[model samples]
Target: MQKKTIAVGNSSFIALIEDQHYYVDKTACFKPLLDSGNFIDLITRPRRFGKTLFMDSLRLFLAINPANPGSTAKQERLFNGLKVREDKNFCDKYMGQVPVLFLSLKGVEGSSFEAAYRALVQKIVDAAKMHAYLLDSPRLDEEDKKLLREYQSRDFMRDLANIDYASSFLKNMLFFLARHFDRQAMLFLDEYDVPLAKAASRGYYNAMCDFVRAFFDTLKPEAGLVLNDRPVLKKAVLTGCLRVSKESIFTGVNNFSINTICSDNVSLSACMGFTESDVLALLDYYGLSSRKQDVKHWYDGYRFGSNDIYSPWDVLNFCQCALSSKNPLEFKPDNYWIGTSSNDVIDEFLGFLTEEDAERMQTLIDGGSIELQINDELNHSDIRRHQSEDFWTLLLFTGYLTIAKHAGYKKYLLRIPNEEIRNTFRSRVQVRFSVENRSFAAHGLKLAEAATRGDVGGMAKVLEPLLKNYVSVRDTATKAPAENYYHGFLSALFACAGNRINDFQSNAESGYGFADIVFSSGYGTDRLGIVIEIKRTARPEELLDAVDNALKQIDEKNYAECLRRMRCRKYYAYGIAFCGKNCEVGGGTLREV
Candidate 1:
């Protein structure tokens, strides 16, 4: 049994098959797609959810060899042993029998409208070159061949005047292929909305939207015609992260069907992501079955149309690390999904948070949920308006949040999907709110003053109010203990406090053990040092006991060793215990080192 290689970032179906990379069979999605009556299908999922792979696989499965039309041998070998191979009759009807045009808009992004338009034209020319054999067809006249030849040349692609025909490039290509094969072509466009998304972020949204609208005009029924008055487009599938409204770019295409994460279409639900069984089998194949719980905790909470799915990107990267490690079991789960993109969506979303919205954000980070109306079809322009409805909708569709449960008509209880996403939210929340620390600087200063004076009760009073208002990380039994959450909160608080606090260190070395927090402040003989230990209690009744034990630990471990080096005449060692938003603080008597 040879080990199968994991394709970390590869999306090429043919290459993956030829190279024998481990793959989860999503070919079963083909049967439903064929049975679907819609002329154009738009499937939306978050980025890095295997949308590109699925589209590329579909392209090879249906595409005929343009140079050698009688070649099913190549297609057959590529799909061998996959689930779609089991459907012999269906495969015989459709496989290797049609001209397929596949285009990806993932790279069609730019800082300006002109730049983005040029990129799109390049994409059109690239797709045209894929089926260059159409130039040799006897059914096509010299004029059609001349047009394709122009499309293949570098001069036509670089001509700024050709921008006018950019929207119709694919349409003309479909016509040329249809005239040659005497069969309508199927179109598969991947990352269809990337240009609009990039344009919106770069402030050229309207210009890009108009261009996309014209490009989508090719999907209209009237535009799908060839020389013999036959429809050139038999079926089309477009993949993107969001469903831009029909009024925005996809105007008047009645046959356009959408399958989003929230849609009830069960067929495409498991296609874009890996199901539990898919992940389990992958783990077992690599002898990492013991890591099932860790994998599920970090990557598995996405609910796509009533089916639980794990991010395929996260799963593959995790498996790659485990397989390369000497001790797979000791490998800890990581936030693999965060590095896939710029995470600008989360940043833009946090920028619009009102104080009221901040409370809702707190709820989500604390392992709870917030209810809101989710609009699956949102225009790019709406995001510019900073509409709360649009922001929440974007968050849900972009994978920052998932539906815990459907509430009323369009309302949903949305929450952070898993530990990986939750961690992202917590870190972002800390950064976003810390910028507005001036709002609570008074409380932070009071807490600092209390800590310097050994006033434990006063410190608790200051933190209690701040805790009630601030966003908190999840503190469930399955998660890292709440102590870490409190530690970050206090660290941020002390950092923002006035000049009274200095040389702050968190979880730094002390006497015989690591101290949760150590700092020195004041000057000359009035210079003082402080050491703090933090704890979280399961029940409120144990708050005082937890505080007592924390103080005892500090004393036993001589946490004041760092303060002694700081040359402080005296120091205070305080113990803090938090139970939910409430807390208890106690400290040993101030003493000379």
Candidate 2:
């Protein structure tokens, strides 16, 4: 099969189609949304789940080109071969029939309220420029034209940044478009809650809220509206990661409909992410059908409504990487989703971790689910409180956690979604433990020191307490070998030494085998090296035997040959074994290379 070009980061609908990039046909979602008859709709999904791309497709499908109002030839070509084009009646009635005001608040963020308010107004100016032709439309009065010109100017945008001036901005923009097109405008507000989330994180929530609440209130219909007495908007759809409560942002707005991860509407739920069939078809097209199970293990645990979905971003990225590899079958899957955005929210949430929460988190890391009251509608302020429910809710919406099942009213079982997200949790937990308890780092360095001095009992003393108190891994749900987890824990502990250790290597090839860890520290004559081998057992009684076996392997396999190669005059080799939290340590006498 021929490979279609995977546009890994292209979110524009027109660009994806015109550039001939591999496009997932989500155009089918357009019909239901248009036929719902609801004046306003809010759809929330996790970040990078293709929400932006979905909204762009909707905009391009419905928007009447300001430059050529009489023709949709360009859009017709764009939608060609897509699933929605199959519906002739739907296409004839709605496609390219409406004026669309597409505004994204995703980039409306700053360190302070003033700066963020400036960004918001700048976005308004950018949106208005798209309709600069409205200034020349004979249907608009001179006063409306003057306002449009002012909105498109940077000088006027500076003045409009204030809450009082910006409050009526959207209403007036819709009115101008309505007059130009002789029809009420459709509004697509993407990432609508981004400003508020940024504001909350930066300690300016109230000021931003005052502006957002007033700005969004324009969606409501008023009895005194002119222009044939039609409401300013024919329809409005807002896409965001979290659904801010109606009482907060959408105050007084009637006929509002929300589709979230927990929504009962299966169609709406499947709209944002790739369904199983979508993934299978994409993989088959890319000739990666053999790797379907590997692909699912990393990125396919997200549950949206009644459908199981995969992260479109991750799947496309994985496919792109696989196709680029010499042997696609041997290409290992990676955590592509975590690197796209800040995992600081997870870090912040983990900072408030208590003893009970840590245990619960470990259970989640072990592939087990925990019951929590899930609230899909949460504002940044609710997240700021660090309540358990709020944190988990944020996690669910942000794609770190997924719903395993519903337990009771408002209660649901949540687990780390897949291997990619589980790895994120594990790394974050390690950092959280290292940062929150400064003594943990001290103990970690001391453990290394003990291992370097061939003091087996000292190494065991430090390892046992840490393994018991701070380790986040156990018999994971995937049933991966326990040795890898123990190896990771020891590597993380040694990693905390930072600059003190000159070099640290994990699973580096040595004389005859791959050593679990080999590191060199100090300088000149004082330079020293340490070699470690980690093992895990199911029963405490087997810990000593595991430790002895590890020691034998380190010697027979010449794990310390790596230390000698690193030019360390003196080196120490040790073996550590773990059964749950308890551990045993063994080592040979310190030796010179």
Candidate 3:
């Protein structure tokens, strides 16, 4: 693979140009969105899926329009010969037509609610000042200017009284700029839901919602009137991970239209990042076609609509890793997506999860679907139900997930989209639930002994506790605990074994059937293989019968196909039976041939 030329993060502009990493062309994704002459369309996407970059590209495009004599035509040079320019009609119709108001609500990591609200307002004011400059309006009188300066000088606490009216100030600013510019203003608000998310996690959601409602109220009716009169106020485009519903913020704004992940009118999916062709080109460029399957399995399954998509951030990061490592396996996945958001929210949610919820979570993890409601209210108290096949759907819609499929909805399946998200979720789950140490140490030790000595009885003894503690009774209407319980036991055993006896895998397919567990010793010298079978028996004699049945199945199914393929000299197989917490272990009783 060739050396990578781009770094992935919010600091792409600074790093992409300065660093020597090769960057792929992602400008094509934004072409249709930018070229289309739509106004007031909101695009919602999951976090770290390139929402910020899309907005940044738009900002760059509009700031450099050639129609405005004062605009920096030189800045327009950055986009010359790009995909947007390919559409001659769009370029002529929309290019350089109006001034753009781009603002991001992402930097509100305040120490307190009041402080954060103040900081958020200040960001708007700062952006407004840029608009003021662009409009060059003398609408502010001397007294008004003095008041604005005085308001800016006060501390957050001292300014709290006037903070309730901060929206009016911003509204007035937008109105003044529209009148001054003599053209409709296009507002691009990026990460518009940050404050709500921050407040929700902090238990200050009410305050944040109130502030936002007031803030948005200033933009509507009043701003609409100004735009109607001035013709300069064109449209607004808001992008965020979550769409705070109108009922939640702009309660009475009947003119508003929301283009969310579910919206069919807006093709926002393509705007956020590259498609499959983009990834193939990059992979081909790097001469890493040999690892194409691995790349697809690990990072290639995000779909946002009718089109299959990949997270641009993950693709870039993968490219950078492949370029640096001759072996793709050496590349460590980073949880870039989850790292972008505050962990407190996810941690809190996980902490409150009930056992039933955890079981449901497993189903979601195992590609099962569940119904969830989307509330349009401020508090998310109302529920609008939708069927989702996996947790990936919930994760993507809630910013924890991303598009893994783009065909019709039936073809989509969501996983932890990239290395970044997988790592983040792993870390959060560990931190939040690691304290609940269920006593599996004794069981783990016995299981290890059984594997070492090929003692089926010892294995049964250890697995008995697992069956009692983890498995649900048949009376319960739960899905069969095949993969979930087995995997859990394996993980617990590995953890308790002090990481010494590694190289364990389960569900190895054989000619006749599949083996439940096949654990091998990590040490090359003390080689061992152990096969385990689990059963629920009605009587003590049934335990022996279960063992006999397992042994027959093992041979009939050719469970040793893999071992035979490797030409191993000797192999160990054990059969185990469980009746609730009780178990019996014994050797395989070969059939008399």
Candidate 4:
């Protein structure tokens, strides 16, 4: 494959196109959103899923100045040959035709509302500089000009940074932009909840909430004789990972529309992430046709309004690494997206981990689905509260998990989305809670190393703690015990080893039928190919019987045939049984569950 540039972070769309980066054209989303009747929109999607990129694109597209020939021509050239260009009529009608007031509160981070509020002020300062040409506009009255200058003034910002003034300040600013440009303006708030989330982490939720709440109320300013009037913003769109409730952010704002992953909104469903076709176009261009299925398995399970989408950032990160890696083998689909800013909220969530939290996590990790009361309406403080509802909802919103199906009546089935996210969850559990002991990965590796050497006692050491702490009692959605839970527990351990083991699999074909688990050592795999059969019974008294039954089944089914097929120098078979938290193991040399 020839070399290709790829965007890794917050680079410009124009830069991505002009620099010849591998671009996925999601321009089809532009027109539908532009035409959507809702005047104010709140689009909630996980971070790094291209929310900022899409917002930036929207800002640039609508920031199109029809009267300014140079600016219009530049935007047209930037979008030339893109998916949007195919619809010339739509492009002609809407591209850069109005004023845009774009504000991103993403990077405003601090311990107190005061510090974080100042960071927000800096964004306004930057916006003022971008629109400084408005000062010379004949349309601006002396009053509007003074209002703009006052906002730009550092002293004014400092005075306003500490109260409700900071919240309603943007409303006045938008009014100024409207008057200055002689046009109603579209407003974009990128990472709108970031400051609130930061404040929640810092224990300033109330102060932050008071400020943010009043600020959002600006979108619904009353007008006319009754004074209960419409906001001046022609159209407003806000993007964030989680949806803070209308009761909080939009308090009195009417006719507000939210396009979240859980929504059936057609236009916005495919808006946030790159669709499968987009991914295919990218892979075909890069001559990675052979790895299509690999990418699909790892990055492509997210479903939004019947549209399957892949994380554009994850796809780009992997493709970039692939393009740069001299050896093809180095381009493994490890969780490259994890170490990015994806897990900061997870770390915040970690501080509140309890035993119940560990159990629920294990249940999800064990390939079991969790049913939680789905409340897409949430606030930043909700995540830090001691509530299971908050934990599951936050996980679903933040991309570690996704909705499997709506169970109806405010309940949703949630699971680890795909291999990429599954690996991420496993790694997180081991890394974060491995405190006071060997990190989770170390213990799993020690067990993997022992299993390779056929050390039953060492495997016991690894299996015991895992069952008690990380393994859940219930199995699948069906609530069966033996099969899914044990299978999930073993799969999770191997997954924690990461690339240490090759072909570490569950319910994979072998011998006469399928084996519960099997793998050969390579990265962390043992030279001996191993197959395991698992049995579950409710009676701890029958643990021995369960183990024996599992062993007999393993032999009768010839589950070890998969190992023989591998032609490994040696092979090991294991029959494991679990009854409650109790376990028994039986195999070629050692017996336990």
Every candidate's lDDT = 0.83, 0.81, 0.57, 0.72
Query: What tens-digit string does per-residue lDDT give for candidate 1 at 1-593?
Result: 89889999899988888898998999999989977989999999998999999999998998988777778988789998899999999899888998888899998876567777778777877877877777878988998888888777766866777766676777888888788888888888899999988888666898888878877787888766655677898889999999988888877787888999888789889989999999999999999999999999999999999799998999999999987888888898888876777655544455445676777877888899898988777876677676778878988888889989988898889999899999877665445544375356546666888898888888988888877778453443336656888888888778755455777999979889999999986665667899899999888899999999999999899988888778788999899998878889998478887
What RMSD value applies to candidate 2? 13.6
What are the C-alpha RMSDs, in order, of all predicted structures?
14.9, 13.6, 17.3, 16.7
Question: For each candidate, how many residue pairs have backbone atoms clashing (under 3 Å)?
Answer: 0, 0, 31, 16
Task: Indicate the TM-score of model 4.
Answer: 0.69
Tens-place lDDT per residue, model 4, 410-525, is: 78888787788888877765456444323454566566767666676677777877778765544433645436766776776666553335567788876577878887763212
lDDT of 3 by residue, 1-593 (tens): 44555567753432443355444445655555654555456777766677777677666655424235365454346666567667666555555555666778987745356767777767856764554343333654565555455434435324677675475554554555555555556667888888776665444677777877777664465445455555444666788766666767876664466655545543555666667777787777677666566666656555565666676767777767766786765565544454455443343234333455455454444444433433222232221121222222345566554434334533333344444444555565433433243235434644675566666566666677676766665432247663344445555664454332444557777566777765554232234445555555666667778877877677677676655433333457766665544567666332211
Cα lDDT of candidate 3 equals 0.57
**Per-residue lDDT tens digits of candidate 2, residues 173-245?**
8888888888878889999999988888666899899888888877877621457777868889999989999
Q: In candidate 4, where is summed lDDT lowest over 10 consecutive residues?
A: 223-232
Instruction: Compute the lDDT for candidate 4.
Output: 0.72
RMSD (CA, angstroms), candidate 1: 14.9
TM-score of each model, in listed order: 0.73, 0.73, 0.62, 0.69
The numbered model that scores best in lDDT is 1
**Which ten contiguous residues of candidate 3 have the minimum total lDDT?**
381-390
Deviation (Å) of 296 in candidate 1: 0.4
| Candidate 1 local distance difference test against the native | 0.83
